[model samples]
Target: MGKPVACLAVAIMILFLYYVIDVISHASGNRYKEGDPIPLYANKVAPFHNPSETYPYFDLPFCSPAHVEEKKEALGVVLNGDLLVVAPLKLDFLVDREPESICRKRLTKEEVARFRKAVLKDYFFTMYYDELPIWGFLGKFDAEGIDDSIVTSVYLFKHIHFEILYNKDRIIDVIIQGDLQNALLDVTDNKEVEVDFSYSVKWIQTDIPYEKRLEKYSQSSSLLHNMEAHWFSIINSCVTVLLLTGFLATILMRVLKNDFVNFTHDEEAVDEQEVSGWKNIHGDVFRYPRCKSLLAAAIGTGTQLFTLSIFIFMLALVGVFYQYNRGSLITALVLIYAFTSGIAGYSSASFYHMLEGKNWARNLIFTGSLFSAPLFLTFFFLNTVALAYNSTAALPSGTVVVIFLIWTLLTTPVLVLGGIAGKNSRPEFQAPCRTTNHPRQIPQLPWYRTTLPQMAMAGFFPFSAIYVELYYIFASVWDHKIYNIYSILFIVFIILLIVTAFITVALTYFQLAAEDHEWWWRSFLCGGSTGLFIYGYCWYYYGATSDMSGFLQTTFFFGYMACICYGLFLMLGAVGFRAALIFVRHIYRSIKCE
Candidate 1:
């Protein structure tokens, strides 16, 4: 026991040190002097419409350095589909360069065909200098003419103009533009043609501080245009929450109080009248739910996900996961989720024990895999698709091994320790009323009062509260838009959870009042139904709002969205069950029973 404990401690310390060193290595304090070598890296190129399907920049017939070299990046960057390689162009800090030819190449039929196809699909290329990125279109297709006469033109940009902004020794911004007017090459035919790749660089002094350089990208014109709409959606959700809260408060205080008064009448009066409603089911309200192990595991996973979301939002709000850091958010997510596995184990073990479950080992194992198993299968399928397409989104062998080791060495041990502690300290299940030897018969109800309709009603309000926000989130993930509004997102997240809890509690009360004793699973499904609506909304957004269209992008989008919705379902369902449990215990404990 002592040796095992020591090993666990060593493993945790090692993981913590690894992340700390990684963060320190990414410190943004790069300083350069005049005439210093400024290396440029060419990243991936992809169709503007299908952002997920990206190939290496060198995949096209672009000019390359004699000895090709790739830039090492963080795990997050690689996962985000970035493949940065050293470009052939020469650049120097604070030095202006006149237009100069990079290389001359005679285009073959195959090369010309590839370029034309890229232009027709509207491909874009990304480059980076000193950790700052810039983008430009490869080429364009245009058709225009006077009335009734149309002339089609297909051309590629042969020249690039780079405008870099700097403040003293720090680089503020880097902008790249394709010189379409001056260096357009006609690519309408398969004839052999000589192409000259030329570029010009200009350095401009700017007063913007290095700390504030990322604001320009975060505050894009598109974001500004939608800012008012975003705020309006937030306001509308707030109103919905307020209305739900008021209705819940009235039901809890007024209707429940009257029920309590009638149940507390004199013994003679109580004998004369029939006792129905929730009071009649006091003996069965706390019956152990079906699939007890699964329920415990789901609640535990939900608790971990809820905690993870709060931590991420707080970190993003405080600028730890800043906009300039390309892969920081995803990196944080992976590390945090690994560390939070212990919470899942603890929650699951305690709940399982409370439910009188005897298979402790099986319960613990199920808790650990409740969320990750499906996620791993999904990623495995997607990774295979990405590899077949030769896309940079595929995870490398080393990254996969490292992640596996982290889960095995760190996450598993912590989870085991937590489960042991939870089992040892598990609280006894306490119900306000004693259970009878047999279950009571349940009365039939109307269609609206049934579980399905109740779930639909309970789910729609929560989904409506966040569908508007989902648009922005989808835009950020599928499109190339950067999302920096963490504070607003945090507010909406709180609203979503609150609305879910209130509606679930109200629905549970109604079900119980109608003499339904099986509120355990129904309460959870009521809240989890919101995930269905959220997934449906993803389908609508993909078809209507987004330009993304391709097999790879479609699979990646829906696959990941499904994972996200499942996590939300678990989190929301756990919240609903907890709320209903509290309401039941309070009302039962207050009853005037003999």
Candidate 2:
């Protein structure tokens, strides 16, 4: 007991230390004074379109420059005409006198004519600011007297200022603005079109302190000021789940206790009562599910995802990745998923073996490639479209090759090793109730107790628990808002898990009570149906909340959404199965069987 107490104390101290370190990390080295060169990175260029021509009707062609170069440590991209360049500025308070380089590409007379025609054909410039595209041509362009021979020069302007108060660290604010200046060249046109870039910095000391400045920088915009509402929803959902859990515990536990006591009485009482309901189908409860190999593979893949999600969230909580660190999250996900392939292989093989499944090779292969194949295909298609549009969002060929190598060299080998280990391990599918040679026939269930209704009921609770938080996540992803409340997200994640487990157990009990011995697939689908709700929510979000309008954006949204939904299906299915497995084993073990 003392040893256990000591271990618990040590664990508590370690956790406290971790939190302290996390706070210190955020507070330290975050100061930026005046006269610092702020780093600006370009994302992509897209054509601007009117609201009427946004979605299905929008057919504007956007492109990244054919060539990019760095001169004197300054990056530049060649632009022939008006184009929207997305250069996101970090919230670093600093100013540099050095101007960014922008190379102007001179177009021939014929090329200029083509460019003018393209511009007239609904091709306008736009830029991304605060994650939303600002139409550059809205009121900034002067189109009168513009023709083929007119020279267009683009100007990039960056302004940075510090808001400081006494005894407080200064807060930095940055604004990036661009303007297009056009002039016609005459005979003896010795004047060359030159691109001008300028930056200015200013400091203002006020009563606002550093903490307030940081808060201002990290605070959610008006559009995302639903944090309180989200918390309310979460609390409401938690109360509902708690009530359900209490009801379930009261009814199931009390009834099961009485049943166990009565059934374990004298032999005469036991014979008189006999077995009924769930006990009647005990033999079939643990029977191998049909298509056991497929189920096993899914479970394996889900386990891998579960492990990956935990680590990712922990890393996020620790501030290893942030919204400003572009692509860091994706890179971490890819590497973590690759490294966790072993868990998938091991889980799939072990579960398949437990189910007495043959086709070990097929099961192993399916486990390894089930999730990865669709992910790769979706990414490939999206990247292909991006490349065709010459968008910088497209992954480079070398990066793609590296990902392939990681999958092939590291992921695949680890999976094979894990599969071997799982196969060699002892089979441990022992059930509390002995399964007979013949499977029991499942009885028909009522409408409310049917598979579909139970799944809908089971899934609704978990989805409800997270839908509010889900909206914020969607805003952060699609709207480009910085989500800094990792602690809240982590809490909500825990709540979601609890709700999923409780709801799954309650639903599984009802199915078993209905004499539906075929609970394996039903149990899996019951929880996983949350993904359907999530997909439906996605549809609603696209049509209602999001302002994104383009064929490429639409395709990218739905295409990647499919992968996300599929992953949720696997994850929730595994969660339901594990929970139901434990519940079933507990109930069955308490029964007095002759």
Candidate 3:
């Protein structure tokens, strides 16, 4: 049985790797011959401020071909607010076309008003062909030759120039440049307004391979500035980690050594050492924390999230998600999270068992739902808002059902298996010192050493280390900016883990020195407080920097931010708790105890 099971697992892993590699290789459009027809897809349009709130391209009074068709998209694309539909225009591979009008429409009063509003709001259009994206603004703001004071005229772009770059038969890049000056229509309140929508196609052969094509899109006008900023942030975080490590190695280690010497001396002198400082409450230091079930569940879920983050970042670093498909990233996230549910189950169940917890079924359920339930509720609320606004972000019923099935089929059974294994294999709770019959009295400390102050201090350092990179990440998510600096991201992630672990261990040592026996949950909160700081930073960014406004943008931003903050809390909290646990055990074990 064991042999068969091991063989099956090995085969399954090989197949999974092959499938992933195949998907990445062909994520872009397939090869095509000369003169073969290439299909164009029109995605949604949205204002600059609220990128998530998207409406269909045909929402405006644009003329369509006789046989317009809707395209079926992947689940990730749909979730990303992309509603791809067949475009009315036709194009042939490697064929150049002269300027030709695809559709002409005489706008009525209402239609002209809508177009004017869209242009004024700075709306942009998105289209895709051969899996390459094209972007263009709907209109240009009027100004007289770089002088904002001189107001000329407001006009909409009526002609689009498409430049397609190809390597052999594969499309390398698609560029859309609107002829705003030459082909434009004046925006007036005239009752009869005629507009001609025209386009031209040009193909350029490039030596760049298909794999290197995405590098062009990954770059931005502020590439130099962003690179400098990223390096500076990385260096800053490295300095911070070095300082913390030095403190831990020199001061913290020296103090703990002294404490161990005094503890042993007193133990030898009195047979039972007169309790004081950390040694006074060694008995109760390892006592099970209150709300053990919740803590266990949180730790379990956090373990899974940590693993998921590392896997995704590594995959991204290897260029798996830069295939010009937004859905591919989201799809990978969902699938990875589902598959890693077993980690959460095992961690939670084993920890709960060590805490002497009962009601195994309840603990298992809580562990499974700890992270997912809140996320579901937030998505539900956001989906309702999207539906009311007629935005493509609203998930369809079928997509919802598919997600449910994935959770039910792929996640649950693995979680059950992990729980069973954890329950059977759990060892007895180990402590360096035995607990007394009665709990020791914790003396009052200075204002700064209190729980709230420690949390504030603990959270600030970690937040400071990552806040600079947070701006870039926020832009990528909320402003449609492409984030391709996975290497920097991975480095910053490692720095965060190092900083969190060392700081928590330092703070835990201080708490124990102050004779605080209730270090279990406090250590977790100390590390977890970074999430609170991050959430507060979100509010600051939204108000001070972000141009986003309106109910839809506000709710969506905060809702998703809340979920992210909560996850960070759990993951960091677990790191802190585990670090402190090891530290406390070492310090206590170093002394002589009855």
Candidate 4:
């Protein structure tokens, strides 16, 4: 049975690795081929009734007539009644050239109605430039050039510039800029107006290479102002790990050596020595924690998250998610989370059984809902805010229903099956030390040695290890930057695990030494507290580094972050508890108690 289980586990891991590698190898690369149509998506359209409320793509008008194409990727939507062309603009630098209009077309009555509705609703237009989105108004243009005429002229400016700044080699940076100017459309008037559309491209070149230009551009974009800070974070983490390793080594070696000397001595001589410390509480060390049901459920959920996270990083390491693949990351996460529901159910049921809990059905139900309930509620709230604002960020009602169905149809059933299997298959909970019928009275600990302080201390090391990387992640999500360095992210993730494990074990030892046998939850909290620090950092980043403003952005930021922090809490907590459990069992087994 053991061999089969081991083999099964190995097979699953191998399969997962193969799938990730296959995806990275064959997935759509981010490079843009010649003549690929650049899609133009509109921002959220504020409702006419309430100007502040917005909904993303719903009820908005496309540049062309509403029609679904068989090949979706081949089409581009119109923005601000202007058809955006994606062809590269070539300039003749030797001689001055005539201005060329890229797109000029008349709007049909239906298209005109759609454009008018969007204008009244105040929808912003967005254009994509090499995976970067630039947002602007449809009828607004820079004040540099303007002319008054009888016919209303709506100018669509396409500014293309190339710069080569260095002497060694000419590396050019290509920039595609889009902006608009509205002359005839008035918000108060309902009359239809004819508008002339014109576009022009301007190219400028310097000696600097494209790479150097990109480096400068990246510096200005986010809080990653310097590479020194990244190096510093890595160095700090390495130092902390080394210190933790030394501390754990010294303590374990000293305690184990003392235990060996005491165990080898005669029983009479051993008893003659002082009857104090961990040995005194051996009888109650393995006693079942109060509210075992809750702990079991937490552990189960944590285990599932742990498994999911490992696979996610593994996928990321192999570059499964590239900048140009829309929704790939989110889609992967949702599917993986749904599939891993069985792991949560199984682990929870097994742990609950070991704790001698009778209500297996309740245990399973709680295990399934533990993370899912809060997640659903948080997402619902964010969706509500988006709906109220009439923003494009709001998920469609159909999508929401589909997600719910996925959870119900796919996740819940698997959880039930796995829970039943685990309940039946789980072995009895056995400890080297016998548990007492009555709970041991935990002694008073020093002020600095209490749960809160220990949690703060234990959480800091792990949080510090990844906080620097966290900055880049936040920038990519919120600041519209491209993050393609999966290899660096994978290394940071591994370091986070090491830091979490070592710090958790250290804190568990301190707690046990203080005669606190209730290490189960404490161990979990010690590692999970890292999420608290992360939240604190988020607050700091928002106030200091980020320039984001407006109710919609704020609502999305904090709302999604709440779920993220909670998930982190679960993952880190489980890691800490597992490490401490192994250490405690090892120490107890090494000692011979009468």
lDDT ranking, high to low? 1, 3, 4, 2
Using all chains and alpha carbons, the TM-scores for the candidates as numbered come to 0.94, 0.74, 0.93, 0.75
Please say which candidate is ahead in TM-score: 1 or 2.
1
Comparing 3 with 4 on lDDT, the higher-scoring candidate is 3
- Please tell me which predicted candidate would have the highest lDDT against the true structure: 1
- In candidate 1, what are the lDDT values of residues 1-594, reduced to their tens digit? 233334544654564555556555655558999999989999989999888899999899988878889888887787787889999887799999999999999988888888988988889998888888788899877767666244377788999988899999989899887855778888877777899999999999999988778788878837667788879878987897788788778867899889988888674567634988888888888888899999999888888898778767766765666665778778778877877777777788889999999998999889989898999899999999999999988888887887789889977887787677678766788887888879988888999998889989999988888888887888877787787788888888888888899899889998999999999999999978899889989999989888888889999989999999999999999998888889889999998544
Better of 1 and 4 by TM-score: 1
For residues 541-577, write the lDDT of model 2, one tens digit per residue.
9899877666677777888888998898888888888
The lDDT values for all models are 0.84, 0.62, 0.82, 0.64
lDDT, candidate 2, residue 336? 69
Candidate 2: segments with Cα more than 4 A from true spot: 1-41, 46-67, 70-173, 177-216, 223-226, 270-274
Candidate 3 clashing pairs, residues 3+ apart or interchain: none
**Candidate 3: tens digits of C-alpha lDDT, residues 1-594:** 123223434543553475469566775547999999998998878898787768888887776767668788887777787888888777789999988897888888888778777887788888888877877888866766564755466678888888899999898888887854678877745456988999899999999887777677777534435687678767977787788678777998898778777777746465444657887777889888888998889888888888778877867776667736568778777877777777777788889999889877888899999989999999999999988998888888899999889989987876776676667666678888998888888888899999999999899888888888888889888877777788888888887887788889899988988888999889999988999999999999899988898888899999999999999999999988888888888888888666
lDDT tens digits by residue: candidate 4, 1-594: 133234435644775676577565543323333334334333334433232244443244333334432212211111111222333233322222234443344545565656655553334544444334434443322223345322232332222222212222222343433433332333223344444433343435477643344455445444455567776776777777778778877987797678667665675665535766667788777888878888888889999998888877777766566433455566667777777777887788888998889999999888998888998897788777766765545565656677779899978987887687678776687688887788879898789988899999988888877887898888777665667667777787778777888888877876776678888888889988998898888888778987665676676677767778888898889888888888888888887755
- TM-score-based ranking: 1, 3, 4, 2
Better of 1 and 4 by lDDT: 1
